[model samples]
Structure formats: C-alpha cells, structure tokens
Target chain A: MVVLTVLSLAMWLLTVHDANFSRMGQLGLVSILGWTYFVGLVLVTMGFANELLRTPLRKTWLLVFVLLLALYIFGTGSAVEPIASLPDSYRHAGLLEFIFQNGYARPHYVADFSWPGAFSLGSVFVAFAGQTNALGFTRWFPFFIELLYLAPLIVIVRSIGVGRRAAWFGIALFYTTDWIEQDYFSPQALGYFYLLVIMAAVFATWRAKPSPLFAGLRKNLHFRMARSRRALQLSRLKERGADPSPGTEPTSLSVFDSWRPRLVSAAKARRPKLVSVFDSWRLKPNPPIFGTQVVIQRRYVHGRVASLFARLEGRDTTKSLNTVQTLGVLGLLVLIMFALAMSHELTPYALILMLAGCLISRHLGRPELLAVAVLLALGWLSLGASDYWLGHLSDIFGGFGQIGSTLTDNVANRIAGSSVHQFAVNIRIYIILGIYLLAGVGVLRRATDSRVLEVVAVAPFFLLVVSSYVGEGLLRVVLYALPFTSLLAASAILPQQSGLIRSWLPDFRIFRYGRSSHTVIWTLVFSIVLASALATTVARGGNDDYESFTKGELDAVNYVYNHVTPGATVGTISPYLPFNQRSVGSVYWVSLYTSGSPTIKEITTGLLQIHAQYVVLSQSQENWGEIVAGFPKGWESRVFLSLATHGFHVVAAWPTASVLQVDPKIAKKG
Target chain B: MSGFLVASAASLSTSPAELIVMVVDFLLLSIRACSGVLGLRLTSRDSRILTSATVFFVALFIVLVVVRFKSLG
Candidate 1:
C-alpha cells in the first residue's frame, strides 16, 4: 500500500509538472493533463479498493490511500493551473479584500455581502497572514476545502452503520464522484463544511428512538392506505416464515433451486399461495441488525494520543460520548448552524430539510434542532439578508413548484456547449443517475436497522422545487446528498441480503463471495470506482477552457485593475475573464454574450452603449466564444477590428490576453 | 409598501438594530442550549417550561425582525 501510494504521488507530481496551462483546450484542464495523471488516479483508486476488500481493514493504510486519491482528484487542478480555475473564486477574493480594507461588509452593495460570514472571517485571516488581499487563498481553495470535508465525512460514513468496508468505499466513492465545483472560494463551500460537521455530530451522538407521533401517523396510514394494508399483510407473512438471519448460508444454484425451497417452506408454514404483486411490493420486517443502536464511543485525549502511536488499530467507528460531552458537541453544532445560516442562503434551508428527514426517520433525538435551524435560517433571510430580497421577492418565490423548468434550465440547457463539453455533461448526468440507481438497489436489497440514511439521502432533492439559486440548485442538491448516497451505492455492490427482499429479487448473496463466489464482486467495485473517477475528471475540468486563466491573462487583468479608475465599466464578450478582483462595486462589468452571439456591429454598439472604458479580449474569452457560444473562429479579432474602427485601441497586450481602451473622444461621440 | 420595505432594508445598513438583534438572538440561543444541560429533563414538566421559553423567544425574534421592517416605516 505504501509503495502504491508513493508511486501514485510521484506520478501526480510528474503530471503536475508536465501540465501546461497554455495548451488547455475546449475541454478544460484535463486537455492538458497527460497519461501520468490518469494512471496515477487509477493506481490510487485500485489501492483503496484492494484495501477495502481485505479482511481486518488497515485503517492507517486506507486513510493514506484515500487522502492520496483526494489529492489526485481534487488537488491536481490547483497544482497544474497557473492561477485559480474559476472567476468566482477571484471575485470572492475581491469581496474578501473589500472587507479587509473596510473592516466590514458593504451591506446592500451585492447579494454576497448580505450573507457575509465567510468573507468577514477571510478578511481577518488575510490581515493575520499579513496579506493585502485573498489571492493567495484562491489558488488552492478547492483542494484545501476538500481536505477539510474529510474529517466530517469520515464521521458521517462511519455512523451511518454500513459495514466497515462499505463505509470506507463510500468515502472513496464520494471523493471520486464529487465533480461539483462548489468547493471554490465561496460561502457555499464554508456553509457545506459546517453542514457536514453538523451531520457528523448529529449522526455520531444520536440513535433512532421511535417517536409516538410518527408511530401513530404510521398506524393511521396503515389502516387508511391500500399500500400500507398490503405492506402490513406482507410484514406479518414475512415474520411468520423463514428465519431472516445471516446464518443461512447461500447456495450456488438456479433461482428456483436456491429460493424456491424456502418459499415452498414458507408457503407450507403459512397459506399454500404465492405472494401477490402488491404483497411483493410491500416492505418486509426489518431484521434485528436494522434497528440496533449504533453507539459512537467517545474518545479520550490519551486514547487518541495512544492510537496515534499505535502501528495498527482496529475499526473505531463507534463514537461514544457522555451527556456532558454530547451537550458540548450539540452546543458547537448550534454555533456552526448559526454561522451557516448567516453564511449561505441555500445551505440553511438544505440543512433544515435534512434535519427534518432525520427527525422523521427517528435518527434525531431532539426535534428542537430542526426548529432552531428553521428559525435561524428564516430570521437571517428576513432580518440580516433583507437587503438581498427586498425588491426581489419574486425572484426568490417565483420558482416555487417549478421543478420541470428547473430541470430543463439546469440540465438540458447546460448540455449544449460543444461536442466535448456535451459529452462531459452527458457523462455527469449518467454518473449521477447511476449512483441514484445503485442507491435505490441498496435501499431495496440491503438489510439495515434504520432507514435514516435513505431518508437523508433523498431529502436534498426537495431543494429542486426552489430553483432561484442561480440555476445551481440541482448541483447543490446532488452534492449535499452525495455522501449518504455514496454509502447506499456501496451497499448495492456488497448488499446484506439477510432479511431484505428475499423473494422479489435474485439473491445477491450468491455473489457475496463467502466460498462459491469468485472475484466478480471486487471486479465490479473496481470498475465502478475507476469509471466514476474517470468520468468525474472529465466533468470536473470540462469548463476549464474558459474557467481557468493563464499567468498572462491574470497579469492583464491586474494591469486593468491597477490602471482603471473607480465607477468605470469593463466589458468582455464572456464572463470568462479573471477580472473583478479589485474595485468590485465601483468598477462594474458587462458580458456581451448575455444577449447571445453578437455581430461586429452589435459588439461595437454594446461596448459603446455601456461606455466601457476598458475591454478585455483574452484567450479564455475567445475559448468561450468559440466553444460555448459557437462563435466563428477569430470572431474576437473581427470584433477588436470593428472596435478599433470605432476608436477603441489596444493599450496593452499579452501572449494570451489583451486590453483595449475606448478613446474618450469616440465615447463622447457615441 | 415595496418602497417602505426597501427603505427599511436600506436603513438596516446604517442602524445598529440588526447587530443588536443578532447579538441578543445569539445570547438567547446560548441560554436555550445551556438550559438543556442545567438539569432540565425533556420528559419532566420543566421541559414544558423550556419549550414555552423557546416558543416565546422565537416569537420575540420574529417580532424583532418585524420591528426592523416597521421601525423605519
């Protein structure tokens, strides 16, 4: 494992060294990344999968491999890029600089300042680090934030009560499939971090204790609903027949030979008729393992220190805490939730839904947590961030129950950039669908004590109904659900079919590889892990063509920022330039592509209309024009020529970017 | 009404009311959290007291928000 880790790390370093940002094509950073990167990714993924399959799982080794895989997937972009990949990252830095200089957020200046927790803290960090701006933090924030997610993700995967191997596999799968680019330098990233910690604390400290409210609700529905009636009858019949225990060894035979004898016996024991379709659709009784309390044992300081020195440690998934310690954790979670409420607009609502799901599934002990989350989120939106929605109430509430339009806008419209980009988008859709499919199988096929994971996994999808989050609602939903969904997906590959769906589906236990099964399970897992990682690499970097900036482009933008006066409008054909890192509110920006593909006359008219003092024509903007907007080749050059004819001239030029300033005389004439 | 709401939202930037509300809310939240640990059991009548206090605080918080909206109005 160590050798494989070292080899993969070395290969990653080589890939990073070999990468040239100048060569990045329409497909993004992956275009410039060579074979070494892919090879390294496969090596680390294979190592993690192999370790998971081994008995008495090596915790330290698996940790090393997973971290290595994280670096390969999340860190490579930062290491290879000349600057940060996204313009929003630098714009966030600009906001941080604003706070750093002013010592407070500019309320009502922008929507971001309305929820200013992340930027305010970032300002303090910048000052403490003796930096004037947050540009240093922007370059590698994705990698850093992902590493921060690991601690909470670990606790979450462990406390969900999946098998040790499946838990670890889920962690690996989560990192590999996390292609969503929200981990950039933003409030959403920090809010997501807080969300994960809250989930971990909740999962680790509490066990499902059935509430009378839900139980009574279930009882009323059981008598009132037809499906519930079938489910009740099926539950009674399943309870009467065959012992739903793992002790029943799986046999290698046809479906009839393996399952019929049990069905025949169950039929004889009960009525002599087979289960009807409605009965088969009903849920079977939960096995004893399903509802068992998962105790997360508390760790003492000395024990943690001792374990640090220990060479090999067994699985320590159970986090045990006494009442006082649990209270402390809960207090901290509340603080984090409050901060989350103040930081991001959407995460608090997502957290509220997730906590509601936990309450419904009986995973949470106290329902007050949900109430408090709702209050804080609503209070902040109404009181603290009133500046954001004061005149835009319709923008916030307009998309209510518009799930179909949200899907069309988020999914269908995004799939039309270019052939390569469309392929990346399609593969991303397929990967998400595949994960959800596997999660569905795991929910149906695996025996579990609690359905908390399934409930929490599906909870974030409700965010889709509110589509006003800049069209990124679906992405955020998938990201928030990925950790639990990944665990459920892992269970599909290694299902515990002890008491779950014994008759409706073929016994996957035959492939559990106790004695008769071969390497098929491992092969399936390996293939899925590798394919997901490869697909994620394509999807994650698919936008790099315009998202990533070169050193020359950054320099050109900095030159413009240094020279341009306040209140001046900067124009670009696309929002792909790495500007907006200074004079944020005073210096405005306009994108020409918002009105779709512009002719030379339209470009000239648009720039003149905005009175843009400086216009940036960069390689990334050119890439966006060609790839995403389907503009003709060298369209930017023709636009520049037309601009020159209208008295805009090149003030500065770089290898990959150029800046043009409109003459004051020409601007006045226009 | 929209103009009034916008003016009230704009006032939030200059007025210290929003800060005062947030600080007080945080203090109240701390109290609520600590009450759970200071020998108040959820199954006891004391829990009803806690629940009532929580409800009152929430109502007061909402009122404070409304006051922020209406104070300038």
Candidate 2:
C-alpha cells in the first residue's frame, strides 16, 4: 500500500508537470488531465479498497490511502493551475491585505467585512510571517484546509457508532463526494472546520443521559405500550412459532429482547404490572443480541425516547472521557463556537441546528451547551455584525419560508449554463441525490440504538426551508450534512446489524454469492466509490475553465492595479479575472456582464458612462462570456476593437491577457 | 464574544451603538461563563451559584438583545 501510494504521488507530480493550462476546455482541469493522473487516481483507489476490504483494518494504510485520495481531489487544481483558481480567493486575499494594512475591517465596503474574524487571523499570520499580503496562501488553501478537516472527520466517524470499516469507508467517501466548492481561502472554510471540531469534541466526550423525570416517564410509557401490544395480540403474532409449548415454564423478561417477558407477564395479568409501570426505570445488565431478529420500534420520539436510548445506549463505547477532560473539551468547544460566530455568517446557524439535533437525540449532554451556542451566535450577529443588518434587515428576513424560490435559485438557476457546464451541474445533482439515496438505504438496513446520526443528517435541510442563504443555502446545507450522510451511506454496504433497531427491512438472504459474499460487498463498495470519485473529479473542477486564472492574467491584473490611482475605476467585460487583489475599496470595478451579457455598443457605452480609466480583457473573461453567458466566440475581441476605435488604446498586452486604457482626450470629453 | 470585543477594540472606534452591543455582549459572555462553570460538575454550592448566575445573566442578555434590536429598528 505504501509503495502504491508513493507511485501515485509520483504519477501526480508527472501529470501536473506535463499538463498545460492553456488547453483547458469548458469541462475544466479534468479535460486537460492526462492518463498519468487517471493512473494515479486508480492506484490510490485500489490501495484504499484493499485496506478497507481486509479484516482487522490497517489504520496506517487506510489513512495513507485516504490522504493520497485527498491530494488527488483537492491538490490537483493548485498544482496544475498557474495561480489560484477562483476570483473569490483573490478577493479574500485583498481583504486580508486591507485588514493587515489598516488593522481593521472597513464596514459598508462589503458584507464580508462585517464578519472579519477570518481576515483578521490571516492578517496576523501575514504580519508574523513578514509577508506583504496573503496572495501566496490562496493557491494551496483548498488542499491545506481539507487536510485540516481530516482530524475532526476521523474523530466524528469513529465516535458515531458505525463499525470500524464503515467509519473508514465513510471518510473516503466524504472526500470523493465533496464536489461542493466552498473549501476556498475563505471564512466559510475555516468556519466549517471549527464546526467539525466542535462536533467531534461533543461526540467524543458526551453520551446521552436522561434526567430522572424523563426516565420515569419513558419507563411508564414503555410498560403501557407493552401492555397495549399484548392486548392487541401483536407479540403472539410476531412470535407465533417461538412459543414454549412442550411443558417448560416461560423465562424471565430479558432487557435485550425485542419484547421483554416481564412486560408480557404484566400484560397477561393486566393490573399490577400496569401499576408498577409508574415505577422509576432502572438500568438492566447488558446482554448479547439475539440472532438476526428485526426489532419493531416506534418512530415518534415523544414517549419512546427511553426505550430508544435503552436499545442503543452501549453502542457508543468510544466515549470514555472523565469529568475533567469532558469539562475541558466543553470549554474549548465554547471558545471555538465564539470564533465561528465571529468568522462567518451562516456556519454558526448551521452549528446551532446540528447541536439542536444532537440534543434532541440525546447525543449531547449539557443542554446549556446548546443554549450557549444559540446565544453566542445570535448575540454576535445582533452586535458584531450590526452594520450588516442595520440597513439590510430585509436581506436577512425577506427570504424566510420561501423554500420554492430558494430551490429554484440554488438548483434550477445553476443548471442553465453551457452544455458542458450543464452536464457537470447535472452530474453534481445526481451525485448528491445518489449519496442521499444510499444514506436512506443505510438508515433502513443498519442496526443502531440511537437516531443521532439520522437526526443530524436530516437537520441541515431545515436551513434550506428557512432561507436561501443568498442562493448558496442548498450548497451549505449539503456540506454540513455530507459527513454524517457519508457515514450512513457507508452503512448501506457494511451495516452493523446488532442494535436498537436491528433492521427495518426484512432480510431476503440475498447474499448467495456462496463464500464470496464479502468479496461481492467489497466490489460493490469499490465500484460505487470509484464511479463517484471520477464524476466528482469533473464536477469539482468543471468551472475551472473560467475560474482558474493564468500567470499572464495575474500579471495583467497586477499591472492595472499598480498603475491605477486610488478611487480610479477599472472596467471589465466580466468579473472572472484575478483583478481584486489590490485597491479593494479605493478602486471601483465595473463589469458589463455582471448580470447579463451585452452587445459591443453597450459595453462601449457603459465604459464611457463609468469613465473607466483602464479595462482588462483576459482569456478567462472571454471564456466566461462564451461558455457561461452564451456569448459569441470572439465577442471580446470585437468589443475591444470598438473600444479602441472610440477612445480606448491597448497600453500593454500578454499572450492571454491585455490591458486597455481610455485616451486622455476622450476621457476629458466624457 | 471575546473575539468580537478584541476586533472591535482593534478598530479603535466606538459609539452608542457599540456601547449597546457591548452591554448585550457582556451579558452573553457572563451567561457563557456561568454555563461553562455549571458544566464542570462542581460541588453543590458552586453548582447552585453558577446556575443562578446563568439564569440571571441569560435574562439580562435577553433584555439587552431585545433593546438593541429595538434601537436598530
């Protein structure tokens, strides 16, 4: 496995070295990636599959394979591209530069300024490193941030009560299915990391312990339900063939049984057991599970919480932190939550929803922890981000309950780009739906004592129903749910069938592959994961045709930034170039195709109207026009020609990027 | 909230709005501290004191947050 991993890494290095960014198509980097890249991916996939399918899972080999896979998925863009891929990353760097220079975030400049924790931290790093700006970090931020996510991800997977193999597979599946491109050099990425850390700490240190009052209520409810089931002859119907008819007496009620006999006897008597049902619930000794028996359980959580906990309680034997360690973890979690609240706008809300789900399913102890998170999030928004909400209250509350439109904006509007981009978008949607479908299967097949994972996996969807989060709500919610959803999806292939709810679906003994059932299952898992990884490779990098900038383009942007005075206006046909790394608030940026593509006359008129001093026309902006906005292939050239004829002149030009400045006489006339 | 305080101070600007934010923020910090202490599994006396502190500070925080909301409106 180690040798395979090393070979894969070497292959990746060769592929990146041989790759040419100039030949990228609308399908993005995957269009240009060579056979060596594919070979590297296959090697890593084979290594991981081998590690996962074997007994007594080798942790070291599995981790190496997983890290190699992460590198292939996340590091390729940074290595293959001449510069950072996204314009937003450069904008974030510009924000960090501003904060480092001024020691403050300039409110009213951009909404992100109001939540400046991430930029401030980046500023501190830049100052400490004696660097002028954060531009250098932007190139490899995705790879670094994804690696940071691995630690918490491991803790979360292990602590969730999925078997060891399922946990490991889930981690790998998470990397492959993570096509959501939010892991840039941005606040949301760091905020997400903080969220994962908090969840890991919670799952590692806490177990569900019901209050005395709730315990008594649950006990009485269970006893009454048992009586009712007996009265209805449900138990007799379920255990029809298992009757002790020969001459022997019935055994005692077994706590581990799907149906306890004490409750059964009480139901037969029908009076005193109903009376002692009011007695406090007591802990029963742990026992082994009966073979392959499906447990019929109530789905509603109101009265069934105790039995639910009883059935699932000992599955999570991983959490063994003593009181002091637990308390210390709680403190660290609160501090992280505070930082998260100050860093990003939406993640704190996501955390609150997830924590609430945990509290509901009894995965989290200390109810006050949830309240603290809520207060911290709300309090920070109301206070720290006051400038953002003071005048834009409608932006905060207007989208509430508009689920239909939110879906349209997030899903429908995204699928209308170029044919290639449309295909990528469709594959992204299918990948999400596929993971979710597998998770549904896992939920029905896996035996578990608690509903914590299900609750958490479903909880993030509520964020979508409430607000569109400026049209990225669906993406954010999917990201928040991906870890748990991946774990559940893994359970579809490797379910641990010995818990509270053994299996909702009846078994058909379909694993008739003779002694090769394990091989069959492993093959199914590998095929599914490899297919998803291939699809995700395209889906994740599909936008790179326009999003990834070239060195010439970066130099073009830097040339404009260095020449333009403060408060000067810079014009572009689209907002796809790497132009926002300097003079953020002082310089104004006007893009003609910001909302919609326009004619050459419109571009010329708009530039003259804004009295723009310099306009940058780059290959990326042209690609955006043709590929995304459906403009003519050479429209930018025509627009540049019209501008040059009217007032603009080419001051400097690169192979793929060019800068045009308005003639001084024409500017004076305007 | 501590992050907010440090960031706000580093900006070297303050106003009545900021003061109102500080009041609510301090109350939130107090509630958070009390909640943390209560989670420590302390002696009965300390637990009682912390519980009382949490409730009191939570109430104060709620009032201040509401007031600030009103002022913003």
Candidate 3:
C-alpha cells in the first residue's frame, strides 16, 4: 500500500514538476494528493486481503477503486501543466501543440519514418489524440498499452506451469526491457504491444476448448437428426432377432460367453480389492494425459538409434555421442557455412553438393535426402536466375543476400562519414548466428524421432529465412536466431539429463529449485538474463541514438508550431518530419511521399491547401546536402525559393550539423 | 410505505446514474447466468455489454463525486 502510494506520488511529482506549485492551485493539489494516497492504501490493502473477501463483488470493487485512484492521480498531474508550456522533448509534441491551440485533436498522419511505423495501435492512439484534441486520452493510455504486451507473457508462463513469483519476475523483466522503454515515447512500440496482445488472444482461444457458440454452430441440425436416426436403427436391430453386434461372428461371442460370466463374477467379487486383476485388462487408464505425438515418436526413434549405435560400436553410444559427435557436427557445419558465406564464388551447386555429402555420410533417410535436395535446388535457382520468376525465388531463398546488402549498406555508410564499429559488431552477430544454426541442427540430430526433428528443423529455417528477409541485416538475423537456438538447445540438454547438469537447466524441478511454492524460478531467471542481454547489446549498438535525432526533429517541429499560422500547412524535405509534424502538404522532396498512393498525395495536398506557409529543410551532411545541391537553377527567383533566400532564418541548429529555419511569408500569412 | 421509503433511501445513497448502471449490470449478469443454465451461449456483444456495464457503474460513481465536488466549489 505504501509503495503504490509512494510510486504514484513520485510519478506525479516528477511529471508535474513546479507547474502546479507556480499556479497556486495548492488546495486542489492537496485534495487530489490526499485522495490518491488514501485510495491507493485502500486498494492495496484490499488486493492483499482479496482471499478473505468472500464475494467477487468486493474484489471487483477494490479493482475499480484502484483504477479510479490511478485516474485521479494521472488526471491531476496532466491538468497541472499547460500543453503549450511543456518541454519540446516530450513525445507527441506536435499533437500537444495542436491541442493547446485548437482545443483537442486525433492523430492524422499515418505513415512516417518512426520506430514501429504508422500502421499500429500506438500510432492510432496518437492520431486520435491529435485529431480529437482530447487531452484526457493521454491519461492511463500507456498503462493500457503496457498491459496488452504483458498479459500474453504472463498467460504463456502460467500455461507452462510457471509459478507466480517467477511469472511476476518475467513480467517485470519485460517492462524494463529496452523494447518496452523504446515503446514508451514512440507509437510504434505501442503497435508491437497490440500485436502481442492479438497473438496472445488467438493462442488463448486455441488452448481452450472451442467456445460453446462455435460448437453449436458447427454441430449441424441435420447431422443431429441423422445421428438420432442411426441410434434408432441400432435400437431396432437389438430388438429384432438378428445378432446385436454388427459385423461380428456369433460363434466368436458364444465361445467367449462360457467364460464371460465367470470373469464378470470374479471381477465383481474382487470389487473391494484395491488392485483387481481385471484392472490391468482395462482398455485405457484414466487421469487423461496430453503430450505431442511428434515428441513421443522422436523419443522412440532416438531409442532405436541409440540401440543401433550401441550394436554398431559394441558399447553404449549415448556418452560418446553427447561429448564428441555433438560438438564435432556443430563445429563442422559452422565452419562449412562460414567458409561458404565468406567466399565470393562459392557456387550454390558446390554448397548443395557439400550438404548432400554430409547427409550421405550421416546415413540420414530418403526423406532427409529429398528435403536437402529441395532446399539446395531452391538456393541454386535463386542464385542462378535474374528474371521475375528468379526474383521471387531469390526473395524467398535470399537470406545470405539480404545480410550482404545490409553489410554493404552499413559499411558504405560508415566509409561515407558515419561512425560505426563494424568488425566487432558483425563478428559477434555472426558468432551468435553460427551458434543458433548449429543448435537447430543439433536438435534435429539428437531428436529421438525423425518426425520431431523434421518439424523443429523446418520451422526454424522458415523463421531464419523470414527474419533475414524482413531485417535485411546479418546482425538482425543473428539476433533473432539467438532465441530460437537457445530454446531448442535448452530443451535438448535438460530433458534427458540427470543429477548435477539437470540441476543447471530449466524444467519443473530446476524452475522451482529449493522453493516450496509452485513458482518456476528458472524461467524467470532465464527471461531476465535474456532480456538483460538483449537490452545491453541494443544499447551498446547505439539503437537509442535515434532518440537524439528524433529530439532534434521535435525541436524543429516546435519552432514551426510556435511561429507558423494555425491553418498553414508546412512542407518538409524529410518524410519523418512531415509525418511527425502531421503537416498536410505537397511534399515534393522525399521519394516515399512522391511514390506513395493517391490517398497519401491527397492528404499531403490537403495540408498544403489549408494554408501551408513554410517550407523547411533539415541540413544534414549527407542527404540534405544532396537535396540542397539539386536545387534547380534560377530556383531563387521563384516565390518559395526567394523566401528561403531572403526572409528565412535558421531558428535552431544541432551541433552545427542540422539547421531548422522559419520562412518570413509564414509570419506574414499568420 | 416504510419499506418503500427504506428502498428509496438505499437508492438515493447510490448516485442515480451509478445505480442505473448497477441495475443494468445486475440484469445482464442474471441474463448471462440464465443463458448458461439453459445451455445457450452468450454472444461476444453480450459479454462485452456485461463487462462494460460493470465498468460504467464504477466510472459513474467517480464522475458523480467529481461533479459534486465541482458543484460545491
């Protein structure tokens, strides 16, 4: 109770700063603060003592009370600061400025060069606020988004029999992760949360039994009638003088009938017995169990393989396979792939042949042979072709190509003036990728059943290909591969092991460890470790550097908002600026806008038509310089160019690299 | 008349809007229960409405308090 109250108060104080203090709304502030503290205490106490609360109504009331308290705290804090006076660095600055000037608005611009892009729920929320000018929308909005992302992870852990404390730990790790932090200010992060929520909801529905409504709809009325007719037929057959058992020989039944009564009587006589002889003869046991058939088949196949190897080697091969063959195969594959990928002219044919030789040496079955052939064929076709058909194939099978493109782009950019540590980062990425790929293969090799191995192998390859395509970077491919590989490796190592090593891995016992409670401790530990590693790597790699750039953009936007007329549309050279500014205008500068659909052109033109008074260009060293150089001859004679040449002045410049300026005509128009 | 007066006092203690929402929530809950008993499945809208009604009552209570304080001031 104290913690919740303290946190709420702290957040409120941090957000409002001295805005409320200066306003002399001390009485209002005190009232709100007191209510917030009081309500927090009440809700916390109720939540803690929820088990003692007999009725569901009481528990619900407590939840509602907490929500209301949170609302009050947030609302009061939000109300303290005038929208116009808020710092430019704050996210949604343009929307806030619009709200201050126009009362309320929803977000308008859809597509932008922001993290997570515009086609997300977070962007929707931002757009809503910008378009509607509803200041109240900001309150409790982040919490809802966070809840959406967190709920899936919690449910997944619980479904896997993870304990409460561990689940909470995982949730906390998720909240504190770089992804969540990044999402806090950007609309794209919010979209990712929504995507996760949608996936979780789908998963939940899949896990549960079909909904009654769906079941009823699926159970055809005609089918029910037909079932009844069949039942009637069965009953009529029993009533007749014909044999009741369909498709059974009467002689077989008669033969068993002589012993049937004695068997029945003996079973009846032993009914009180705890262990009846007949119990063993029962067709199936109760306590219905569920397990993947694929896994069972894999285990069966593994047992067979172990036996075969034992016969071949004239000893138990388990220990030898685990220590020697596992490492050897993994190392060999990594070495082969690395060598092949690095070489400029390692023909797809040669690679496929090498893979085939490996498969043949491994004594893999015909199915494995066919699969490898197919994969190699696809790779070959992708590399050989350049036409449209080949392009499609290349797109599908061009993971390595994608990585090469990213490497080239990054390296070229670095060479052109960007400060990036390529070698160290790329190496780490490649190592992770190598490990991930090897782990997938290891899982396939070690899987007891061929079917299980096939299933696991196929999915990982698909994910690898898709991720590589989407990311278009070796580092990204490696990063994504890390989790998939870790999961597979962890599953393989822990399940069959015993004693000391088993203690180290995650499972029912290790997850619980020494704790008496039902918590899956190891899962929490794993999640935290993974999330921390990811966060550290992202931070080290300078992913957060984009935030600084965004800040500069926002500063430019603030200048425009302060100086330009309310209805005047502004044109910006950068797609990001226009999107972030929610400025509708004829954006002639960026390729993204120029090549966009008619709807985009319409939206852009609408902003300009409204009263676009300013044209601003951010002067970056690279692209910005090119844009400036491309300024058509005699451009200064034109009205727009003349305004820039004569009346426009740089308002703010960032480290003297980028400059934001205002046009004189904008002031005149206002 | 005494019973009616007691009922009116109880109702008055609750905000009119909140009480109305609570009654609606109660009715929805009862209907849902009855449907379950009759082996009839509730639609998504029914579930959403029931949930929304419960939420609405709580929201109404908070709104009432805010309105009352504002009016008093």
DockQ of each: 0.14, 0.22, 0.01
Off by over 4 Å in 1: A210-320, A497-506, A513-515, B1-36, B40-73
Estimate every model's Cα lDDT from 0 to 1.
Answer: 0.74, 0.77, 0.34
Over the stretch A589-656, how does candidate 1's per-residue lDDT look in tens digits?
88777425667787778777888999999998888878877788888898889888888999999999
Q: What is the TM-score of chain B alone in each candidate?
A: 0.46, 0.44, 0.45
Q: A1-670, model 2: which lDDT tens digit per residue?
A: 7699889999999999998999999999899999999898988888888888877779999999999889999999989998898889989999889888877788678888888888888888888989999998999999999999999999998887888888999999999999998999999999999999999988877665422223223345556444433333323433555554343322212222334443333233322332243222211122112211112132113224433433232222234676457667767887898888888999998898898788777677555667678777877777677777776776876787899999998999888768988999999999999999999998988887677899999898998866898888999999999999999999888887676556777644443212467677768777887888898999999999999999999999899888998999999888888877887799888877754657778887888788899999999998998888888888889989899887899999999999999988888888
Model 2, which residues run further than 4 Å from truth?
Answer: A209-319, A507-515, B1-3, B6-73
Error of 2 at A33 (Å): 0.7
Of 1 and 3, the candidate ahead on DockQ is 1
- The true-versus-predicted C-alpha distance at residue A337 of model 3, in Å, is 37
> By DockQ thresholds, what CAPRI class is model 3?
incorrect
What order do candidates take by lDDT, descending?
2, 1, 3
Candidate 3 on A373-468: residue-level lDDT in tens? Answer: 233233212221111221143343455435455455433433221223233234334434434553453353232211221232233233332324
Interface RMSD of each: 8.4, 5.2, 32.7
Alpha-carbon lDDT of model 1: 0.74
